[model samples]
Target: MEIKFGDAKYYAYTGTHDPASDLESVVFVHGAAMDHTVWAHQSRYFAYHGYNVFAVDLPAHQFSRGELLLSIERMAAWLNQVIDQTVGTAFHIVGHSMGALIALEAAANFNHPDAGLNSLSLIGFSYPMSVTPQLMDAAQHNPSEAYSMMTQWSHASAIGGEPVPGFWSAGMQLSMMENSTAGSVHTDLIACDNYAGGEAAFVKVTCPILFLSGMRDKMAPAKLAQAEADKNNNAAIVLLPDCGHSIMSESPDGVLNELKRFIGARK
Candidate 1:
């Protein structure tokens, strides 16, 4: 689906389902340098099973056409505008990696007694999410190296084999990053590295929150996610064993099941 905000046009994958007023909404936001396709498995399932799914491509990341928002706060604010224009009634947000940070900020700002933010699911998240200098440098001057490093680190193993037939997890991720808009990876890394409001944002969110961590994650460690979840009274953590930063691809079924149980219970 296409949504216009001013002169810019944004693309959201609706799983081939049209939006309706009666159905609840679930928005999926992907990590840095990634697009709506990262949520392919989870979003399509939710859309097919009676929910309005919006797997969004952040501005300048993929099909979305606009200048890239350079910080987490700006991205969060843009997300709020998207929700206001597209979603009606109760809604839930599912986000991963960098997107998780955006979701946190957005929920803190947008969720209210009558705002209809039913729940929040943060996957591959950590507070004070720092990016290494080496990775940042690579993203700026040697993007292919950055993509290779991220792809290798994102999964438990490069050759461990994916559950889906005829698929290579690491290769697919690398391709996605390679295909992203030029300099977007560095832009996203800077946003994650410089953001200092995560702890404050976590406390502001009042709705139930899910911290979905990958046990073997190298980027945002599970321990960090646990610490943040520990701070929030309404937050819970679920660890995906043998998975890494890319939980959606490495443990698709586990991610989907947890989201179903968490959001379904609230409904």
Candidate 2:
């Protein structure tokens, strides 16, 4: 599923369309180092509900061809082009982790005229990028410790109550540290932690925003997400009772159910 665009190549997978009704389109964006496979659960669930689904591999990771620019701006630009090509005007954008930043860029930074998106649903994200210095320092100096913390924190006993299965641990580990030139993985962590635009660009976003968070999301922190969601005139914040950073994996059914209702309410 390679599509040549300018000098870059993007990998895309289309899930089965929803049978309930005709949907405009749905694009699922994955975070850093992760591929479209990350959305396997979400895509299948949503597509079955009667909507077109598109899961894409982000730049520098997986099936995509290009040196990792690692810039959210470039990420949005690439997504805009893809949308215009396939659906002419494209559709709603759903993003997680690093992909959330790209969605923000699409709604705020880039503002593609052909995006044709009516809404945005951002899960596991917080505005103003509160990726504190403590987290950043830990990620760079002690990646293993950081990884362990992620695993431990992902449990229901941690921040939120939802428990992440050990099944995803291997995938997450490999994605973060698989291929690299010595310190590239650490470098990626730094870039992600120090991502820009904070809250200014986000506040200007006019589209309806749906913010998802775990009651105790170690990364985004529930309180922070709620406050960010409050700034938007058309935003709704949902705290998955006992979820962690990876809300999709921690509570796939919860997310899908909420999305089903969200989609129903929109039209």
Candidate 3:
């Protein structure tokens, strides 16, 4: 169903839970260039288990209101509003790719006074340190070049032990291109490029986090992600063999298993 929050409508698969209960909701955030469709399997699975699921499309992305503003903080702030309106209060955050960055930002700023949060899961992402200045500049000057750079990083292999076509995922890439203004990428590359606290912030993430990565991931590239993991002490980094960067689509089973463990363990 759709929850009208702020200026946009958030698409979620929420379960029946008392609105007054401190019972938290699960909000799934999608990565850059992708919409809420990627989490179709996960949202359906979670809703089956009585968990309130809110799989929302971020502002500036398709199926959502507002212009495509590339600021991560702006997206996070809008997301915060969604949280307040949809299921006021406690929540569990699950972010993939760029959405993982949003989860981090939300966890950093979350101050649910009524009660504490449930847990957080970061999937299909490593760290932002992988992006180089040249890539950042390319995305700003010529988005096609940036799009190419992103294409180069996308993991195209399938989790079902089959090879998936690159064109299958081209729609997401195309969305990025169409949403972008100024004839360049929509977002400010500098935000990702200038993400400070590279090492220390991982420590600040006191919540239990699950870092899902593909063995063949090119974007967060497994090696660089490992380097970043050297900094996160409370995180569990799982590597999927023969898989690419697209963990949700590649290994729905693996993703489901990890999520079940993460959510089940809380009880």
lDDT of 2 by residue, 63-135 (tens): 7776665566767777876765565233678888677877777667434454455678888786555455654
Q: How many residue-pair clashes does candidate 1 contain?
A: 0
lDDT of each: 0.91, 0.66, 0.65
Model 1, 170-196: lDDT tens digits are 888999999999999999999999999
State each candidate's clash count.
Answer: 0, 9, 1
Model 3 agreement with the true structure over 79-102: per-residue lDDT tens digits: 766776655345778888777777
Stretches of candidate 1 exceeding 4 Å from the true structure: 111-115
What would the TM-scores of all predictions be? 0.97, 0.80, 0.78
| Residue 47 in model 2: lDDT | 65
C-alpha RMSD values across all candidates? 1.3, 4.0, 4.0
Candidate 3: what lDDT? 0.65
